[model samples]
Target: MSKPRSLSLAAYRVLSWGVRNGTDKPYIPRPEGELIWIHIASQDRQRVVEGFCQRLRQSRPNLSVLLTAPPQADLIRWDASSHPLVNLPSEQTGAAREFLDHWRPDLGLWVGGGLMPNVITRAEERGLPLILIEAEIDIHVARGARWLPDITRYTFDCFQTILATSPETVRHIRRLGVPASKVDTAPPLHVSPNPSPWPEDELIEMTHALSSRPVWLATWVQDKEFISVLSAHRQAMRMLPRLALILHVADMSETEPLHRRLLSMDLRCVNWDDGGTIEDTTQVILTSDPENLGLWYRLSPVAFMSSSLERGSGGRDPLTATALGSAVIHGPFVHRHQQLYDQLNRAGAARLVRTATELGDAVVELLAPDEAARMALAGWEIVSEGAPQTDHLIEIVQDSLDQRGQDHAST
Candidate 1:
């Protein structure tokens, strides 16, 4: 790659220097292994970055991902075990150099709704293999530097590849002097994990056990939302007597209490978590394990993403159920996964219910084979929208990491 034009970086560096401020991230010692350092250029694009990382890890289980974002920090942090997110280092030259020296990544992913000239150039100086994903035509330059001449083209040179969001973006990148070969269109990394495979025997057994019963899953249910879910089930049952609810408790400790409450409701309950099978008259099948959700997602054509009807539940992720072709019913309190829910709702992939009656209505409506299939297909389209692009990005990362590993081994 040709050297990035300085674009008055010297003046910009001097102007923005020497203030220990918001961009100061905690000193998270870099983990020992092959690590991909991702700069989430914008918070809105973080979900796509996460979805990409999740799919990438499936191919490389022990791969470490260090996600970084600007100091405003709407991007969700990963758990400590996985690798927590931190602020992107200050754009000042010194901080940029220090950050690169500290966390020498195997590959650098520039999640490009924006760009950070200083750090990106620094990464290039350090010979990091950089790839920009979700490249938008409108370049988002860092604040306080719009007065500076547009160095966007020079910055673009630092990347090994740029995956543009559209043909327009691809054209724009070329207009900015990026080589056509290095810029190609790809879809945004929309939310959804790669669909996990369930045991064929188990799926077949669950199918035969239900004898083609109309099933809906109510998963990640909190205690406060428990009765509302059950009430919704009872109300929906009035319309379809054969409907069954796979009720999963978010907290395992609440499992027994919830089970007792179900029995008190005069609902026939079976503990699927304890190897219980659904009886012919069973109205509810209970589970507490999150792993079991995969099986249930496959079994049920419709699912209620629980814990939202009650305040402070913050909502659960609906992507997994949607990824498995399950039409979703969610409540209004979806602040945690708001973007995802909004997209699903907008696409008619998910229905939002504020009350038991509404939920019951949604369940009944989605249960109609055509309605359920339509909703599920809509959800699936959203879930799998960027799949081919995601695969291409994954391949590039994998091949680069492998080559980096080989180079290190030889040295």
Candidate 2:
């Protein structure tokens, strides 16, 4: 009812542009079966959706599903082109409502980890057996919600099932008055999309064609972390003559500035956007798309989750790298993804550093075949632990839907 906030406006414009110019996404086709709608609104939402889909597809591969997320890509990215996903418009009322009205999914799954109030209320009115998965509640966000306490309470109440990432969050929401019966505390899902079509032949060819030397990925790099990455690159090249670096920024627009930085490093740089490659002597490849990181992750043996070099970044996610069978290295500042990093590191799946020098050293050390293999195996095991959670989610959803059918029969 009020004017859209700046974040809402920006997200609206991006989603609007994408939906307008975007080719029509084929509506998920299923008749006479239950439908699922997953609303994602946070940076980690993609992982949740992927995990949900992965689990649902396993026992019931033909189940119809729709995945939607916010348009803030640098923070969270959801590309529907290759999967059963749709980019939900962010204005929060008109487009979101229209999407729901059309599908009228039998069961609605809202990972409102970052949802706006209007979107939450709209789904609530439909009484579609809503499940709020991995809901988050922290002090900073609670303070913001204080300005609209009633709306926040109402949103939490909308869910028939409220699954949270931790006991603390579950307690926080209960303090806000959501019934305890509606809540479940569990570890959030951590699934990353596997690169499809193998890309194996091309991947191997890309590796060999790019460099026979050791390659390390500086993934999801942003402005705050670029200078340090460049400096590390220059310093790293001096000792490891055959080492190659891949700089994949969070935003593509950062590519030009990254190239300029490369010029001063005295290293031959290749730009993926410019259709470039690593020559026999090439030192770095600047890739500027977040989507392509999946491919690069599969290609590289060791990767440094970028954005961790800066103080406020909290950190780039290590789960993605772990899921792809690469040894993950992150800075000590991964607070946003603290739980995931903790799980992986505790499982011997990842390593952490406090500075660029330390990160550089770790990168070189992790490239060793024996060390890399050991880390890779651990990383895979960590990711595999998520399968059980995924299984539990599907069982719960199916049982709830079945119970609803039984209630109707009794009535």
What are the lDDT figures for the candidates, one per model?
0.81, 0.70
Residue 401 local lDDT, model 1: 84
Q: Pick the candidate with the highest TM-score.
A: 1
lDDT of 1 by residue, 265-314 (tens): 79999888888878889889999988888999998999999888888977
Candidate 2 worst ten-residue window by lDDT: 138-147
How do the residues 86-140 of candidate 2 rate in per-residue lDDT, one tens digit apiece? 6655443565566667777767777756655555556667656778877876211
Where does model 1 exceed 4 Å of error? 1-7, 19-25, 77-83, 137-151, 167-172, 179-181, 275-277, 403-411
Q: How close is candidate 2 to the true structure, as a TM-score?
A: 0.60
